[model samples]
Target: MRRLTLLVLLATAAPAHALDLTATVLANKTAYIPPQCYTRTEDAQGAVHNPCQTCHTLPRSPNFVSDPDLQQDYAIPGPALENPWTNLFVDRRAAVAATDAEEIRDWVRADNYLGADGRPVLAARLDRLPPEWDANGDGAWAGYRPDASFAFDDAGFDHGPDGRMTGWRAFAYVPLPGTFWPTNGSADDVLIRLPEAYRQTSDGSENLAVYKANLAITEALINRADVVIEPMDEGRLGVDLDRDGSLGTATRVVFAFAPLEGVTMHWAGRAGTLGPKVAPLAAGLYPLGTEFLHSVRYLDPRPEGVTMAPRMKELRYMKKTSWQSYAELEEGALAEKKEDADFPDRPKQFFGSAEAGIPNGMGWRLQGFIEDAAGDLRPQSFEETVFCMGCHGSIGTTDDSTFAFPRKISGPGAFRDGWYHWTQKGLAGTPDLVRADGQGDYAHYLRTNHAGDEFRSNTEVISAWLAQGDLTPEKAVALQADIAPLITPSPERAIALDAAYRMIVREQSFVKGRDATIAPQDETVWRRVEQDAPTGIAEPADPWFYRLKR
Candidate 1:
């Protein structure tokens, strides 16, 4: 009965073009894999290969909540042994060479996400119960509706027409240094919605002040640093906020090793400002009902400059459906490792229907909608979603199987401690992120990775940052002040890359590969690899945060 329901849902929800593609993908699921799973093990020397450190690394400070054993060995499971990403092997230079750059530019610039009525196209479509997306045989969409208006209040909450909060709050953060950087391929944004309990005061009343305070506290706990917040009345809350033995005016949430010791306030706070009471807030984990909505889009390259586009390439959703205690998370990781050891070569299988989502072994379940051949959103096949689990499920770099939220820009310098959207303010004039040891983040990435992206194929970045075949100290200093020059692609390269990806979409060959490439990537990628083999590195590399510490 469950299988029949799923078949009905897929038949009703997926478009004809997507149905064919999904069928093809499902028929030979094991034959397909993402190119990123194949790490570059060998360097130019062909010796001292060190690819394991990219995803598998020693857990670092502020991220010690994950499995520490992941750094000790390679734990790749099934479907990762072969390289089915044929897109990487394709020579797309001809397609790029024949493209009308101007026409492609105009098409990209035209917004596909919004209608002439100035409302979201996906939102309107979902509201109408379109057969192509109405799952469960229900007349209404049961899944997440497009509620983020991109219009946020001062506290970063999105409000609907009834003037009630839509519950989706958009926040800005430093983009993770590699492919996630806009110059690589896509422009993206992430919005978070906490469970209703977190949005209320101690007495269960919906007060915006209490909500903002709760968010600030969560930010402080996640980042493990003092968070600056707008001034609020602490006396009325009846919480002895500063540990100063009295209810006082509080300007920040103090992250302290000993809260009773009365730690010093952040430098951004005014003289005599006190810390908020944080004894009640849990550390490192979001509530079980939390949801994150992320949208990946194309780059809007205009004659003047490049910015984020309104047309989305993909929409991803993650929800925490269950709560795994700290002991449970550790036990789960060890159990999975034992299973991998027993059958290292066997591909691990995930259990779930495509209409719902696949569980990531942790508490979260992920689902994604991507563009079809016609550039409209459709559900991603099971195999495509498996690619997401590899990173979110067991990567050592993640804190609680997540990124972005922990790396959110904070302190007084950031605009509202980075709780806004890209549309509110793009990534220009944003200073380089400084690590705990005060090293520049972007500069360190370029120095270590030697390229803007993981593939090291971004010629635009290589030419700019590695003009002399190396990133010199002088160039590194310049990047520390402003990162725009290091991360933004030239208008010509942006248009060409966009054109290259559209070719893959038209071909409906996402099962084979989905990377946007102007040419074949033979130099950096492998066709196949032996499972559980040594990655050829003597010592595991540190996590991205720890590497920047020096």
Candidate 2:
């Protein structure tokens, strides 16, 4: 058939090459623009809208920027103005259409985390460091080891085969609204690990009860609200667990707006909690040394439904390597803006050692590992890691340069107060997050973006949520109760998307683009744009803070 010939031609269109595991980090020729921002739509009045303000706006707490005016523009460095993603231009419809859905489904469902011999596959790969990935020519990997066992205790702590805690704790939160949703080609999970001091009692003892209380306290501080916890002895903490003028048996960790007398928290001091100086520390500011491991995986679509594949497509790690005072954060942001104004065409340059990971300039160091041509995990090249710095380094939507943990579900309705993994409970009955304006989050996104994803390409979502090609009041109301129907793709779509991405993996063409598209995305993205120009919108959209405001 003609279809088979076209598929064969497309598959061989691009030549395959050996994996590039080099550990060289390269400077960006232009400031990067994420593909997500390309998802633009016109209002009913036919006015074009740019939603860049959603991720680029003034901070809510510790309003760090000295000049709010500078925050309005894209303000990328002059040198880094070129769009670096070349894969956007490549057409892949033939390859996607040619895929055998069932075959891709079976491949995705295959266990990738562990070998049939019962050992971690990624761990084994990492143990044998390839010469190409060793930037310094050292045979050892200097990065954090893949220690997550995927086996969790009741409290969500990852436990190894030796019955020892791996210090990684998995938590469930509503995925970020757009590209991060599972229907968009990947199923991912986030795990958090605090410093050893916070996981210890005032007496320096490793007591689980005290550790739980400390974690709850940190959570309360970040969220600025009372946090529920199982009953614990307050005497062991040696601080007023509940700020009611005295310490007693406590069931909740109460947050105090002001410092309380005789309630000095030694644990807070150890965790480097910088009590209100110029402004209150930004909401969701974690203590230094907190580490987060995130895994982006393939979607395993089945007769039943789609779930996360054990085989990871990408493993991302970030750590709060240093603490930035509120003043330091503001100064750095302002300086970047000034540079943008002075040199509108000069590309931004990043300076960091490749092996340690690139600094996001917000106290966090980010590193990542992605799949090779053979579908085995390999270290991302320097240019590959540079793709990550843009979002994490200076995004208005994030709290302390992070997204998921701050959005972790809370309140009595959440399972274990939102401390469990996705495997424990999928997003089946999770309700739509309510925005500050009291609008259902998903419904508002649909009404504004006019599509399920940023690309406006997900026809499946558009058809379901926007009956008659528009999101009516009835559809909005229906979404508030449960969002799984809107976010989860059909089994066929899932398999097709997975197969398309597998093609990119086989080609080792991540530098071009990483979007899992079944067709060429000419309409959704721009190859280049005018430097420092307005995004052709009348006004900026509201920031994520409005939705996160409790």
Candidate 3:
């Protein structure tokens, strides 16, 4: 019995429960459009590329204000423009998103070009986590790669099941020659979007590419996900369910994450002019980096001694309600930016400040980290960080954003690396704050105007053909950029975006473990054939796929 006792004591216990990483497909309160292509060209590129200010000529440009359906092809995907060989004009454009444009593109450069080498040059992206994520109460979180998978599903993401890949086409960031929507899926020629000219629209009006591609923004990286089509409904889109979705709604996407920390922040309120004060922050209030009336620990909660000034007030943080609802959030966020002390250097240096209290040894590392991370994402795009960080709102459901973050996940063994979960310390769940509009002036936060040049309309330019997004690129045509119309943006595109979102989510969510093995649903829908694309592409399968009867 003594020996048995000794063995029991010495015997290692079975691994404690695995961290419950239930990567549920949650919706963001705000949605954004990824500025389609990620490239760096001077703001002047628009002129050189189009020479007519035609790319930005909205409502219409080439011929003047035009309708999306006027052409057969849709918008161009980012891939086509990455190469100057194919997109010769892209090289002449000036570098506006120079730093970020290069960083984001370089970070995933391998994904751009194909090589004879066996290794695939692509970002093996994990699940989508919030950016600006802060754990350990550090007032900041860094980015890391996660191990996750994405899949395209039919149940939730089938837009047009077994539909012929005839009329669908991929447009170029380059200009296209003619319209081709109902014909073969070929639109490499009609029109293009200026990705470099992307200005953070205050009203969410310009987030076209992000919203369209379901990438939140052009700078966002595609993780392990496969796109598919699905039935669309009003409920999924927060529309009046009673109303008929007369609009041919597209599919809802389903995404699965290995559940890494994405854009997350943990701020403890510190409200005090001089002395400590405890107070509640109002909902929908954002903490201006200014001395607020509350003591809120944003990254870490020092609940023991943390408090605002004698008259300290709570720091209220608002988050985007849904990605589709980003319009509202952007309005709010943009308004807020207009009110703040336009501190350009703040985003990169905020957390490392002495007030933020970096632990002794971690200070240097923290500073260096801020330098590197800020340079990578926020240095040129504070609003992007704010826009991203805001949505991945507070950890758990606490009245005050300050609460104890669970220390471990799985076990000490699991956390050997950075695999810790915020749930182990306590319950409300880990920080998953949402983005709020008016968080920062879009361009000011990013400081992309390093050249001291006019930053208005700094975005990438697409060839006119991509505007249609149909037909084969080889057979695609290019039109002059000046002729298109200034698009007022109708509900049709919005509805299509919602449909695309549905398709991306449902497809990914249903096939959680497949990894990035599956291609995008749109890819399947159009059978996007590009000279740059790989050959012998296999046809994708649909879950509820129907075999049409003759």
TM-score for model 3?
A: 0.20
- Candidate 3 Cα lDDT to native: 0.20
lDDT per residue (tens digit) for residues 1-550 in model 2: 5678456546644635444445343444542457654433344456454445445665655435322232234344444445566666677676777777766776777666667645567677768876776766678877766777888887788887878777788888777777888887889999998777666654455666655776677677666678877776666666567766665777877876443353323343223233343113333566667899999999987556788877788989999888786678878888877886687666567655445677877789888888777677777766777778767766666777777876787787777888888877788888777766778777777776667776666788877777675689987887777788888888888887897788888788887678887766556655554444554455455654454433
The prediction achieving the highest lDDT against the true structure is 2
lDDT (10s digit) by residue, model 3, range 131-159: 33333334333322211111112211111
Model 2's C-alpha root-mean-square deviation from the true structure amounts to 3.9
Candidate 2 lands at a TM-score of: 0.89
Q: Which stretches of model 3 miss by more than 4 angstroms?
A: 1-550
TM-score of 1: 0.84
lDDT of each: 0.66, 0.69, 0.20
Q: Which candidate number maximizes TM-score? A: 2
TM-score of each: 0.84, 0.89, 0.20
**Candidate 1 Cα errors over 4 Å, as ranges:** 1-34, 44-54, 60-79, 116-119, 127-140, 161-163, 202-204, 236-243, 256-281, 532-538, 547-550
Candidates in descending TM-score order: 2, 1, 3
